[model samples]
Target: MRNAPLGIFDSGVGGLTVVRAVQQLLPSEDIVYLGDTARVPYGSKSPETIRQFAHEDVRFLLDRGVKTVVVACNTATAHALPSLQERYQVPIIGVIEPGVEAVLADPQAQRVGIIATRGTVRSHAYQHALALRRTGLILHATPAPLLVPLVEEDWLDHPSTHAALHTYLDPMLDRGIDTLLLACTHYPLLVPVLSKFLPDGVRLVDSATTCAEHVKQELTKLDLLAEEEKAGKLEIHLTDLSDQFEDLSRRFLARSPGRIMRVSL
Candidate 1:
């Protein structure tokens, strides 16, 4: 089981952020990634639909012989993780808890800001997770529904993206937040753009790095860490493929993801 590939899935290519982190941390562990691009942006979908899609994605990965599953989409993690865990025998991990853990890691945090997709904000997963660990947290949660589309469109540094950031952040800034958590995996890609607008003292926490570390810890605990002396391979599967996806994925993974294949769930 230790040599079996780790499975990770997302609504779309945004989950590549998690894959990148995993690569850097567990270079010797092979990974299989599934992107439900045909139904991208699970953010606004109904919870039932998101759950169904997540299950299909998981089934696809499990069929590929993955030992563990990582729910790399914030919306799916928020909505489907519990049920997914109950149904699957393999260990499953989600992005929400790791992101909340990142926020609490900062001892000085008092007022926190969360910017995520509509479904994640609606789910209130981050708020609930944080409340369990800390009290009297002044949280500013907002749904940046447009941000995901902006990212998918490859507008990382476009003036429109900057405007959208400003429009979404101005309200949070008013509440005097000291730490901002990028609640969605895709938001990490906007860090460079987001940092430009944040106050000097405010910190940004994103799940990619923390989640990778969390997965490493889980693998260690389960004695599933790969003992191979060479680097691992990454296989990317998508529900749909396009030139735009190919280009964006290259940017996110920091290298070509080998041969990209399309599969139906």
Candidate 2:
């Protein structure tokens, strides 16, 4: 089982951030990534529908003989993680707990700000998880529904993207948040632009990096870490092939996403 590929799924290409992180940290572990692009934007779906979609996504990955599964979509992690965990024997990890851990990792982190999609913010998954872990920790979660489309459009440095960031994040900054948690997988791509505006004292916690670290730790404990001497391979599967898949995959993965295949659930 240790030699089997790791499974990761998201509503779209955003989960490639997690894949990139794993590739950097665990270079020997092969990966199987599924992007449910046919029915993307799971952030807008009902909880019941999200759970159902998540089940099917997991089934597809399991069919490929993955050692463990990572729920890379924030909305799906929020709505479907527990149930998925209950149904599957594989060690299923979600982005929310890892994100909360990253925020709490800073001993001085108080007044944390979270920016995610409408479904994730509405679910209060990060908020609730943080509250359980730390007392007297203040959290403000804002739903930035516009940023996803901006990211998909590859507007990483466009003026409109910068304007949207300011519009969404200025209020949190004004409230004196000590740390800003990028709760969604796509938000990490905005780090350069975010750094241009954020104060030096404010910390940025990226869920993608944190989740990757957490996966490393968990794999170590589970004795699932692959041999370090061997190089890893990445395979990307999308439910629908969009015209922008190649470009967006490169943007998200920071390299050519080799041989992307389209599959139906």
Candidate 3:
């Protein structure tokens, strides 16, 4: 079971952030990634709707023989992670909690800001986590709904993208947040752009490095870390392969991901 590939899924290409981290951390382990590009941006959906989509995504990954699953989408993680973890016998992880834990561990944090999609912000995942563990800390949550769409459009460095980002973040700055958590996996890509606007005292926290370490620790504790050095492969599947899809994915992933095979639930 340890040698079996781990599965990672998100609503769109953003999940690649997590995959990049995992590859760096566990070079020997195999990974299978699924991006629901056809139904991208599951952020605005009702919890029930997001839960249904997450269930099917998990079933699809399990069908592909993954030993574990990681939900890399913040909206899906906020709404679907607990149910998916209970439904699947294999170990399951999602990005939100680990990220919350990471930021709370920061001794410098007094007022932490979480920037995520509408659903994640509405779900209050960060607020609740800090409230439970470190009630004294203040949680300032903001919804930057444009980041994911801009990322999917491959406009991370575009002039229009910067304008959009500025518009979104200006309000966050007014909220007096000290530390920022890029709560969405997609937001990490914009760190360079964000650095320009954020004050030096405010630190940006993203899930990749910490999440990768946590996954390794969990797998080790479960005795599920792969021992084989087999040439682990990457297989990317999307629900719909738009012309824009491959082009954007190529730009986002920095290479043609073999083939973005189309599949369905």
Candidate 4:
């Protein structure tokens, strides 16, 4: 199974952050990525709907022969992971758990701020995950649904973006949150702009990056890390062609994002 390509999926181009991390960590492994651009922003949908969509996504990837699946979108992680796990045989990794694990492990972590979509924050997934165990950690969650559209527009460095980000974070920063979680995959692209508004002491955590690290370890343990000779080939499947799925993804992934095969639900 080491030669089997890993499957990664996101609501849109945001998951490219996870793909970028995967590329850096496991350069030899081929990946099959799917961006559900037609149904972008799973944050606002119901759990049943999200779960159904996620199942279709998993089925799509499984049809292509993946050894593992990476859930790169926070919204789907909150609402869809459980059902996906029940239906899929391969190992499954989601963005939330690994991110929370990182925050809990930080020695200096006192208060952690999470910036995510409205649905993610409302689900209280992170808070519930951290609350199950006593870790003496304070959680500050902010829902910034607008950022998703802004990131899609490639407006990460826009002055307006800085204002919105500052509005969401300044309160948490003032409350002494030393670590900030980029709860949404797309948020990482705005890290540079976020840093300008945030205090120097604050650190931005990429859940996708941490998730990739955990995924690599899991794949290695399972003897599924594809060799170098088997790489340089990738498959991209999309639910639809709207939202400039190809163009925006290219900017975020830093590649042309070749072979975006389209599929209907």
Report the number of the highest-TM-score candidate.
Answer: 2
Q: Which sections of candidate 3 miss by over 4 Å?
A: none
Would you list the clashing residue pairs of candidate 4? none
Give me candidate 2's TM-score against the actual structure.
0.98
TM-score of each: 0.97, 0.98, 0.93, 0.95
Compared to the true structure, candidate 3 yields what TM-score? 0.93
lDDT of 1 by residue, 115-134 (tens): 99899999999999898899
* Top-lDDT candidate index: 2
Clashing pairs in 2: none
- Name the 10 consecutive residues with the lowest summed lDDT in model 3: 248-257
Candidate 2: stretches off by over 4 Å: none
User: For residues 233-261, could you state the per-residue lDDT of candidate 4 as single tens digits?
Assistant: 77778888754877887878888888688
Query: What's the lDDT for residue 14 in model 4?
Result: 87
Q: By descending lDDT, how would the candidates be arranged? A: 2, 1, 4, 3
Q: Per-residue lDDT for 135-242 in model 3, tens only?
A: 688777878887777887768789888887777666667777788888888877787888887987888888766677778888999999898876667888999888
* Candidate 1 lDDT (Cα, 0 to 1): 0.91
Model 4 lDDT, full chain set: 0.85
- Residue 178: error of model 1 in Å? 0.6
